[model samples]
Target chain A: MNEKMSSRTLRTLPREKAFYFFTSIGNYTGESATSLKEFTDKISEVNVKSLEFHLYRGDFEKWTAETLEDQKLAREIENLRNQNYSGTALKEQLYNILSKYYEKIISKF
Target chain B: MKFKDNTVALDATDLRILNALQENARQTYTAIGKSLGIAHSTVYDRIKRMERHGIIKEYTAVIDAQKAGAKNIIAIMTIFTDPKESDKVAEKLCEAPQILEVYTSLSEELLIIAKVVAENQESLHEFIASSVAPLPGVLRIRTSMITKKFKETRFSIANNPKQLAFIKEKSNK
Candidate 1:
């Protein structure tokens, strides 16, 4: 079924010498290591693990609720805002939630 | 002119010229000078200095593929190969015109993300089969097509104050 869908989609695309922008993340070892370095530097400054930081300044809950359209996940993030979980622990919990959410959504695809 | 750090320095005027040219590279230096309230010769000299320093690489047109009778298919492909053979494989991949950009991921699993262009799906598939799949060390290949693009731009320089300061500082050094 997936093959059929892919074939149909491929056929529908227009003919052109398409320009592509490539980005590789995770386990990338190449000449363009600077790209990864810059990415990590930026991500490190974001403090992704701080639920309080996200609640006050970042859009973590709003993004989860609106963009991801996972109100339950957003609520869970909001709940974490008050919890005493350390930064690393909060990040782990968020990662697990996102992983599960992606698994459920991607299975539909 | 030599900056404090012996690097080429671009003053505010140079940056203004760059921003104008980035919007339309074909703009005459006289026009750019007029807009920025500088002499045309100064504009020309600044641009030449920037080019010499490798700041401005090339000026090229951005053509619409569909309008030009070509199909753009963006693909992210993971090429699994022995770690030792990865560089050789990447070098070979660069020889293919269809492949645009290649990057290796930093995961435990060696993965390659490739951007490819083709006239059609058949050619795209053929390129993968003949050029990529048969590579001696290739263990697996997984490709996902990009269906749409939301934003694309060539200009890395922004008119923001912080970015300008950074550029100035770097150039001065």
Candidate 2:
């Protein structure tokens, strides 16, 4: 019973995931692409994966740890991957569980 | 005119509980009771009664727009449509993914608000140019970004205090 209560406590707790990126690169910036490519390549070199990016329209896009030509773009992708690597998968699994719980909660009303 | 059979009256405690609940639905009954200096059981009873009356319909989490990676934008569109096409236009608006909330207000006010999470300003411009303005019912669209959420509350437990039951009775009719 103690174990059940502990698990219930864990389940009831709220958590938030936040992400940030430096996508403010400017045009006519000399060697910007090369610099960005180098940075993103370094992030990808670390072997991270499983990141997902959400678009403005509630659409989900996957971010693999693979290197891109532009370092800046690559870092943005890697940032998403690093944050999501396992936590995002866990979040999805959790939502599936909680959706069932919400179904029950609503039915009671 | 006969009053609608489904309409019911809410008391003072009921109104207070509702006003508080709208701000934060997850607030504990004990805390709510402490705020009102009532017993926890009284708060629970009032909430239960409110539920039965369909006054308290649902509890929702109000996620911060920036935290969710989406920025809120308010848009007003005046559609020159015949009454017959209103249904189709409303249906189309409902299905649009960018639209977070939509409402039909007084005849002068018809609003459709959308929240888009883009990487930069260019993407936001792209979304407006490509997706929103092209909808069927859209005659003219004006968009504005929300700098801050000043105040938002959905359901209130208390009856509007200053307006006595006379106003409530007339509005309910």
Candidate 3:
């Protein structure tokens, strides 16, 4: 369990795989989160519009699963996405999920 | 009328929390609750509730634009559009990234007040002539370039003490 959570869930990825934040198609927020912890921190600071944009498009699950290689976190994100939480509600829930996962990992160390 | 259904009626605690956040978003939960005589856990719970309700959005960091080399020339434009197409025009303007904010005028004429930012005068002119003036409903556009900014703020939560709901903190705060 610790091995599953430690590697990609918290390990910093290369610049190529960083989750680049965007408010719209061409509008980048200058944030490229390399790890789950960084992504969680960015989620709280990046505009909620960007959060809503990514949530509606299911981009969060895609990145967390494919890039981070953490299906557990990805599935949780997918479930949250399916619930149709929009705007700030979506942001609040996503932050809670990521923070909980982060704390769980930190406790082991 | 529209607010009747989904209004998040803020209680005294919620109001105090919002006021604290407005002052300094970087403050810890303990710092926020210190002035209001509430626990940090209570502060956390209240803030999360506000977020869930979509009332409290993301916390922002203020930047010194000039120091960061992100100095933008501010322009406030008043656009008069065809009455029938006013709403559509406003919506279209919102999709334009150059436009910072879009507000519909309540006066007699179908007017749109939009705050625009550009690198310089040429870009501003290009934006107005090419992107704005050529829009479907745009009849005419009047642009005023802001030379200096005196004050800009989103809210003054402390100013309103008349609300009976906030009577609890009238003494110290």
Clashing pairs in 3: none
What fraction of native interface contacts does model 2 preserve? 0.00
DockQ (Cα-based) for each candidate: 0.02, 0.01, 0.01
lDDT for every model? 0.60, 0.44, 0.80
lDDT of 1: 0.60
Q: Model 3: residues >4 Å from true position, as ranges?
A: A1-109, B1-3, B159-168, B171-173
lDDT of 2 by residue, A1-109 (tens): 2444323322321111101111121111011111222323332322112112222111122211121112333344334434533444534432343344334433443
lDDT per residue (tens digit) for residues B28-146 in model 3: 99988787788999999989988988888788887778799897898888888889999998998999998999999968787999999998876786576546665667766767889
Cα lDDT, model 1, residue B37: 71
Counted clashes in each candidate structure: 16, 10, 0
Per-residue CA lDDT of candidate 1, range B21-97, in tens?
88889999999888777799999999999998877889998888779976667676778777877888888888888
